[model samples]
Target: MFVSLGNLQTLYLHNNDISSIETGTFSHTPRLQRLELYGNNLTSIPQGVFDGLNQLQYLSLYSNHMKTIPPNTFINLQQLLYLYLHDNEISSIPTAAFANLPRLQQLCLSSNQITHIQSGEFSNLPQLRELQLQSNQLTSIPTVQYQFPELIHLNLHNNNITDIPANAFSNQPKLSTLHLYSNRISTVSLTAFTGLANLNTLYLYNNQLTDLPDYLFFGLSSLSNLRLQDNDILQIFPNTFTGISSLTYLLLNGNSLKTFPSEELSKISSIAVLYLQNNQMATLSFTAYDMMLSDVSTVDISNNPWQCDCQMVSFRLKMTGSNSFENQITCTDPRHNRRLLKNINPEDLTCEEPMIVRFEKGDDNSVEEGETLHMVCEASGIPTPDITVILPSGLHETVESGGRVIVEVNGTVTITDVTAADAGLYICIAASPVGSAFKTLSVDVQSKEPATVTSAVINITGKPESTLGSAPIFSLPVLLGSVIGAVAGTVLIGCLILMIWCKRKAKNPPPVPDTSVVFNNTNTTATVTTSGHDQTGQGWSHNVTNPGYAQRPAAPQPTLDLYEDVEPPPNRPTSKGAGPKQPAKKKALKPPKRNKAPHDERPSPPPPRTGAAAGAAAVYANEPAAALDNLPYYQPLTKN
Candidate 1:
């Protein structure tokens, strides 16, 4: 019962049990604008089914059992603008099935069993704008030239796409929005969107992309909103969005990124909202926020796996102190953790073990004299471990040299001023409350001088003296010579004494005019007398008297004049009357003076002397003059 209807602009044949649509089914309906055949049990679309319906603008064939479409099914329908085939059992489409549908604008093929699309299947649909192919088994989109030139929206959600081919949408210059969520896309090619200049929104959530390709959106100059949540993206390329100048919103939550590409993405001045929550990032670079500028207001980078290594300790402090970073970052791993990074204290993120701990000798093999061998122990530990050096002599010393030892946390010790006695097993012990370790060092000492003895000594003696006793008997002459030598020595001593006495008398001579004077000898006393001299050298006699002798008259220029007129004392004897029993009278005398003046110019006479005085003066005169030789003399002046 195939009936032809004229001037039909709409037809409805929904909810039928039709299994097949024969060719030339609508060949007479040239002005048909709309047709509805949904809810049918169709199995296939035969060729030339809508050949004469050139003015058809809308069509719906949803909830069918069609498995394949024959070629040239819609060959003459050039004015068809809408097509709906949702919830079908179709698995394949002929390449030229829509070649004549140039005016098709909205196509809905969602919830189908389509597994593949041959190239050039949609190349002739130049006016097609919106396409929906969600919930299909498509592993990839075909890359055909001029396939959908006016395409503005595409929906490819819930597909089996593991890889996106390069330039997949190169022919779609007018594309603005694309949806590829819930797919198995593990990688995106750099030219995935190479020709999509008018693209604005891209949705790629719930995929398996481990890394963003370089320049992934380079040709998407009009891209604004991007959704890439719930992926296995561990990292992002440094230039992921280099040419996406119009991007303003980006969603990167629920990924495995250890760090964000904030620096690279922020080059787009129009970016405002960035969602980076649920990652494995530990720290954020300072340049990350600086590039965002004023256009960015919110950033959600919470739920990430962060580590508390020393290199990131400072960064952790900064993120905890600031409101923009710490408050937004959340810990996702090690399940028993806080919601926000700011809530977890920094002290809780302490390091567990030291990085390096060891000892090194300056010269590992040999040492020399006067050269100090250094033993250096270095360690790096958390909270600074204590370092100490134990010498072989049971002594401990602190490290001070700059290069020999260094303590990152107090686990460094150095020993200096090495000596031979210090050559033994040296130990460097590094200890902390947590644990301790030790390193052993063997020191070899070398010296030029032996270190055994301190000093040495030597002694010597002369031989015995020789003798020749009874050879010569001429000893008399030798004895006589010895006596003569002794006499000559005595005479020489007497002469030396006399010379000394004369020198002393010359230095202090006796007075020439005094009457009474005293002199001393080595064994006796002596006295001197002199009378006043006359100018005429006449009648000016000088006399010297002794107690036992008369006064002696002065002779003319005589050296000595003595007269013995009285008897000598019984106890004393004169030189002429001396007996063996009487000692000779000892006397000291001065040489007689020579007169050169007359008697008229003589000095006045001296006072007379008593007998007792004369006796005392005589005793003084008889004494030797050797003892008085050193005394000074005085002379009286004569009156004119």
Candidate 2:
């Protein structure tokens, strides 16, 4: 019961209870360019369903019960360009199901239950320009290498895709608009858009992406609108949006971003509308707003988890009543969590007090007498404070005077050429609109020399020498003169003893000689002369020749007892070579007398004895003894 119309170019079979697309159902229509088979109960598209339709250009198969598309289902439709298979129960497509359809351009497979796509499934469709596969059960897209140079738009929303392969859209050079929203995508590879040269619009909202790679939008030069809201994006690279110079609108609300990517996002000059609500942003840094100053016109930054601490006080003041953030901006946390900033006036927002200011000085306090007192004042505050100084001499001035003052915003001061007049209490005053504080400074000037006493000379000459030992002669003049005086007194006592002996000799009388003699004279006459000078020269030359000298008689030799009969024992041992007989008795040895005081006193105190003195004494004691023994001895005077 099949109609055989081999010349048919179009077919319409919509709203029918068709259970399946039978094999060879389009066998007679070899040149059919359009087919309509929507609203049917078809469960599957059988193998070889369009085996002979080689020039089919349009097909509609929507609202069907087809669960799968068999291989070679559209093998003969090589020229087909538009295919609509939306609202179907299809879960999968067989490999090579449309292998020969090289001219397929617009394909809409939306509202299906498809879960997977095999590689090379669309390898033959090199002319595909528009692809819509939204509302499916796909977890990922195949990494196909086909170059669809005419592809301008791709819609893959409402899917379960969790990941995107690197460079998945590289070969699509003409892809300008991409719709990938309402998916379960948590991550995107940077290379996912490697070759998308003409891509301009991107839709990535309602996903689960927590972080974006640095170069995720690198090659998309024509990108203008980027939608990435309703995700868990906690952090973004500082240069994430650098490549998209044409980007104008950016949506980033409903994310967990505590900070904004000011470095990367600010480079885009065309950005006008920015959406940044429902996140955890506490406060906006000045650097963040400074980056987006080119053409930003509107921004939505509400519903954030902001903390209204003291650090935010300055920011609150800056944002309130300011033209920079008057109508388009609002705070999204703290007391004004959901309140419109336009409704709340700037004067109504109050700022909290800042932390206390802490000041620090240098470590060393020893300032030079005439040098500058270099004092540094380091303090920390929310809004920097103004510092003033009061000098010790009651001179008040700012820290800029070169005489003894200099100040800085970093809390440092230097005082120059500080003198004794500059020593005393100094006060440093740090003030702000909220409150003021003061600190005391003390300075001391020290003197430079050691203390001692001066005294006159005190003579202790006649006093006994100290038992412990005399002090050094060079110690002081008074002590040295005392030692010299004691030594001179002992010399005077010895000179007096010699004078007393001479006086006693002058008072004594002379003794008389004996004149009785017996006969038996031997012609040896004993001559006696009263005068010391005898002109006859008979009494042993009694004339005294030397000046002031007395003449003395020669000593007598001992007489020998030759006549007495004595033993000649010693004469038997005499040798022929002996020159002369020795004297029988040696003269009695005299004991050395103690040195007198005047002669023994040295001209100067002997040099303190050291190792050099001991060496000199040893040399003198080692000399020959004969030289010392031959020295003449002094003889004593005797009375006759």
Candidate 3:
């Protein structure tokens, strides 16, 4: 119907309810340079929608329900330079979809539902400079090799892209900037950015990269600014930024970097301003800063966990005095965690001597299993370096040195009764804020005979016994326990011997000593003697009387003496009614019974001396019984 105005230069049929377009719908608009049909009821664009509009340079089909972009959809509109297909329901772009648009400088499909695209889908757009496909459902680039020789800026940010395959920009000689930030990118191929010779800026911040490999940007020679902040980067290789000499601004903020990349930073000379803020770096030292990069305008190492300790604290103070890192540096350690580094006084940065650690100055050691192992490590530093031993089991053990496995306060590791499981490489770390040193000691516990270990002593100063030829020193507790055990065994043996002797003596008693009493008439003495039970001989004598035997009283006691008195009744007095009974014959005294109680030992009296003179008998016949009773007590000898 509008064919009457044949040479229409611009067609503004936007906000239309165009549900369908006939084949020749725009045949009469061949000279149409701009087409504005956005906000339409069109579900899709017809194949020949812009058939005769070869001069159409602006095509705005946004706010449409377009589902798919077919190949050769714009084959005739070679003059189309700005195609705005954002805010559409476009799911995929087919191959050769934009092959006819040779001058399309900005093909923006942002804010669309595009998830997939065929390989070489944007092949023929050689003049496309800025291909913005950000804020979409793209998980990855459509193809590995994107051939855009004239494309300068490619924005694929805010997409669901997990990876950018290798050689994604293989032929992009004029590509200067690339924005792939805010993606789920966890990995990038080694050659992913190998061919970007003129790429000056790259924004890959906010990704899931754990490490940056060496030579990642090998061919990014002109790369001046790189934004890799907010990534989970824990490690960066030695040569990660080797060839990127033009890297003036490197934003590595918000990472897990504990140590500085000194080697890589040394190679990058043009890094005028480097951003290493918000990392796990414990301290910033002069050694980490490259002296060659003196021309570096500034290096922002702020917001790092700066441990203000003796370890290179002097150097940190020196750097704090310089204004190059003025306002950008702040501490994250105790007492000054949020304080600025420049505000800390240089005098407050106390330091001790550097540390030196060694394993008694020896090489790898070997020991037999089931033997005592004494390993010694010593440190030389101010305020004494604290020692930690990392065992073969990968467990860090603080050597408090006690018991059988004693560790001396000066770093001596003594392991008594070491087994095969205790064999391994032991790393001794002598660390302090001043400095730290490490020594590796490989202990090979061999399974051998004798169960004896021959380990040399490494003394207090870490002097190896190989040179001194000294035995390994035993801990006090170990020696004490051994001596105690031996003494207890000896005491036990002595007690057992004593008990056996006692039992033998109770079973068979010793022979009784003979008791013999002799009376000497010449000396008028009666003697008593006792000898037994290893007792010395002893004697006591009593005097026999001339008329009557007057004797000293025996020692008074509860029990009777072994030889007590036994007197017969006095002879009956002669009377008229009683015939004079013959004088009772005087009985002779007999020896007391052996093994008898003192009260029961009643010895019989002996017969009168045979054939004594009749006159002598007449002297004793009147009171013979009385004479016998008058005799001195004849005490008997007692045995032990």
User: For each candidate, what is the lDDT?
Assistant: 0.66, 0.64, 0.70
For residues 341-429, could you state the per-residue lDDT of candidate 1 as single tens digits? 55666666554443336676664735665565655577655433457777789776554325423333244343345567777887777
Which run of 10 residues does model 2 get worst, by summed lDDT? 610-619
TM-scores across all candidates? 0.50, 0.50, 0.54
- Could you tell me which 10 consecutive residues in candidate 3 have the lowest summed lDDT? 610-619
Taking all chains together, the TM-score of candidate 3 against the true structure is: 0.54
Model 1, C-alpha of 228: deviation from truth (Å) = 2.0
- CA shift of 307, model 1, Å: 4.9
Q: Candidate 2 at residue 69, lDDT? A: 75
Residues 367-460 of candidate 2: C-alpha lDDT, one tens digit per residue: 6566666665554332344577777777766644454467764556676666677677777777654556677767665442223324444445
Q: Rank the candidates by lDDT, best first.
A: 3, 1, 2
Cα-based RMSD of candidate 3: 23.2
